[model samples]
Target chain A: MLAMRELSVGFAGGLALRRATLSVARGERLGVAGESGSGKTMLGLACLGMLPEVAVVTGSVRFDGGELVGAAERDLRRLRGQRIAMVFQEPLSALNPLRRVGELIAEPLRLHRGLSRAAALDRACALLSEVGLPDPASRLRQYPHEMSGGQRQRVTIALALACDPDLLIADEPTTALDVQVAAHILALLRALSESRRMALILISHDLRAIAAVTDRLAVLYGGDIIEEGPTADVLAAPRHPYTQGLIAARPTLSARRDRNAPLPTIPGTVPALAHLPPGCRFAGRCPVELPVCRSTRPAGNPACHRGGP
Target chain B: MLLSVEQVHRSYRMPRRRMFRAPPVIAAVQGLSLTVAQGEVLGIVGESGSGKSTLARLVMGFERPDQGRVLLNGQEAHRLPAAARRQTQMVFQDPSDSLDPRRSIGWSITEPLLAMGLRAAERHARAADLLARVGLAPADMHRYPHEFSGGQRQRIAIARAISPDPALLVADEPVAALDVSVQAQVLNLLLELNLTLGLAMLFISHDLAVVASIADRIAVMHHGRIIETGPTARIVSAPAHPYTQALFAAA
Candidate 1:
């Protein structure tokens, strides 16, 4: 159970995430989809109290009736591995090259659960098996570099599940993997969340990845959550102009498109953070922007002037 | 055919793990053959370790295949002189890495022209013209790569790739590093270039949907071999191979 009320993350350049309110219930899978610089990653980091030192975070983040915003580093550290574990996009960098896979998974268990080395390692082996890794016993002794990208990602997932976290924040978890491997990872995440009753926040720029695993979706644009609804509903009939543009932009297998025709693309690139308009972040690039959109902020779940595209 | 790769085979030796053991060789490309006609967009779809990039290198004459031949304009690509090799230009995945951040965009775009012995005046004129062609302002020529966004930098990369007026363009995941919305823009630019310039492209990507959007023909690669090759529509509609079917399902 987590609730974020008007949370904003800002740097010297500008606010990267602005007045965003979101919540996730137990065992819920929430997908945060956005382009680069859309602040999807920042929102995930803010939940774990893992923002950069220079980031100025504002508003409230409540988890399990505990306020995480402005909590002490020690308090955050205690909750991190035990309650809210994260899986990053780059699995290789997340894992230590020098450490064996078993040790990596076992350390978190030992630290958080106070298990003996042998007991922790045994639990680690079980976790490896739980995440569907083959030969869990043998995989424990191998280094991160010894495994393939997909295997390394599985190991990382095992490490995250070591302490049986209540929430898992996977930021572009499958971004670096191949298509088939990516599908496997997404399936694994969905299965894990359902079986373990863990809340998952899957952040990615790819709409297809989001569409595959998440039931609820939040579309971020230039640091703001412009649209939030059922993933299927939002994808099928997006109300916001920016959301429409994003859905249209993605190449789809279902569509029989003319090969010579150009894809439907948003008119302009995302403006620099410092140069973003005070109103809607998608204003300048939006296809049907009213004059008021340029100077005034639009509000609502879809966050638009004339909704229902 | 504008370009043909004939039974190409390439391999690399793996590091030996034990003493007194011969290092094992890893086959990256194995007896792979394909052809791209003039102005045709040939999409190569494959996962990592599938040797798609190795094929690009072989086609570009950057590396000689251990066996078979890579022929460009009916000539051995690896044996072609530097001047002749200029007919092929490449656009890489990450524009930031491919571009020199310190250099002005104009200078980088015109570097290929320099290699072809173009005078300074003509190079500048061509660079300005190329920037406009890619949908960037002519004034952006003076701006450095760091000044632009990822999408804009890719537009600059495209401008550079086309400056030489190459007969064939080898784009290895050109839009992979870009955002979804921005990826569409770049893909559109590539499509426009293909239509207007009649530039044959070796479009390589892991995204089946993206390949489907741009390519006239699609080749599905697995374990360093072409498992399926057909018209793009046919490949997407009714894939013959199970691997291709699985790939489509995954995408």
Candidate 2:
């Protein structure tokens, strides 16, 4: 349903995404995992043709037989909220504080489906209930502030699904919610994608959340797809040093290690965009940094000198 | 126990909108009690509005409990002398926010020492030593907080917290704001410090995995009360409380 080939995005001096290639089949869920400056969000935005004007983008972004790169503004706008939807990390700020959630959700319906206000509102209530929000009728009248963090996120999800888009790009959708609420939101996303046969692009910094919902995993590090494979396979034995570091660094809920021993950590911070290393972005902090890793960028998915499936 | 709280209850009065109406009371901590022995880490795990932070404030003597007492080394924390109070320090969630951006790292680390009437030169030397102890170079002491990364800033915060050689350290979601890889560095540092310095820690966080990793005993809080408290192994393996089970499942 979605394919990105050699999609590169660059600013004045630095590259945000470098020759990144990714694809998601219909009803498939792909997880893009990366830290603060990894440019995972850039990849998501690029898919929807939402990169800022200052950002120079190249290569092909094909979604449902349409090329998004250099597409006309009117065409992009038509596809943005109607055919390709997005859910952000912070729902409170993403939603309008002054507008009623019903109107907000119904606005897309009325605009795209050309429905009357009353009819769109009725559909909006159904969507609210579909996202598992209780008291859907009364909730339509409430503002974003009146709801809990989880409810607000649910409303955001409802708005994204309002147009029944073929693909949904959820960027860190549950990062701000509590653990229980996050779990519920992930489950809802999973179920919705499965039932609706919608392709999902879940971008998150958290490995656990990614591991929970995604079928395939793409590990991004400093604007590159360092690893891509089945989620279970990659998680069971991560080949890339960065992937291994991320997995080891996470404190598992079930596995209890020695309390006195220090946890294994990736030394050095993620390099700033302007100061990124020439070859492998992670080489500076990688434990098994080869000399060649400093001069030549590794090619292909699961990009690494060391052998990994 | 190195530190203990007995039947502590804390509440805040909401401002009344109407002149004739009485202000409503919201209990932040209700009959909460726990302890941390010497060199033992007691993890306080709770979601937002669960009163875990309120408990930390009460333990640090930042807020007084309306009903019960918070005893640190058999003396009330709020009632302790100025010098004695330095024995218990806190490491906040955001190191950048807690540390003054204008001051040098050395100046920030040695502030507690200066308060204890130490000479300026001695304080500077101690600051350098503290930085080295937290796996940072002594030269980093002259740099400001903004010069360091999130993990390094947390190290600076930890160095400052332990500069006074406090027996107890209350870290309230210290690693919550850091990235995963950076969070591991900070968590490991705390674990190492606990072992090397024999410092007791009250590790408060909403992350169950992180709490289970470092805590000797875990206390699960909900709606201003502790629902369950037990050894880390017991809590992870077989939680008796339904809320604890739910928390584990959620994590």
- Worst window of 10 by summed lDDT in candidate 2 chain A: A300-309
What are the per-residue Cα lDDT tens digits for candidate 1 across B28-98? Answer: 99999999999999999999999999999999999999999999999999899988898999999999987
Candidate-wise lDDT, in order: 0.93, 0.92
Tell me the fnat of candidate 1: 0.79
Q: Scored by Cα lDDT, where does model 2 land?
A: 0.92
Candidate 2 segments whose C-alpha is farther than 4 A from its true place: B17-20
Per-prediction TM-score: 0.99, 0.97
What is the docking quality class of candidate 2? high
**RMSD for each of the candidates:** 1.0, 1.5
**Cα-based lDDT at residue B90, candidate 2:** 95
**Model 2 agreement with the true structure over A153-196: per-residue lDDT tens digits:** 99999999999999999999998999999999999999999999
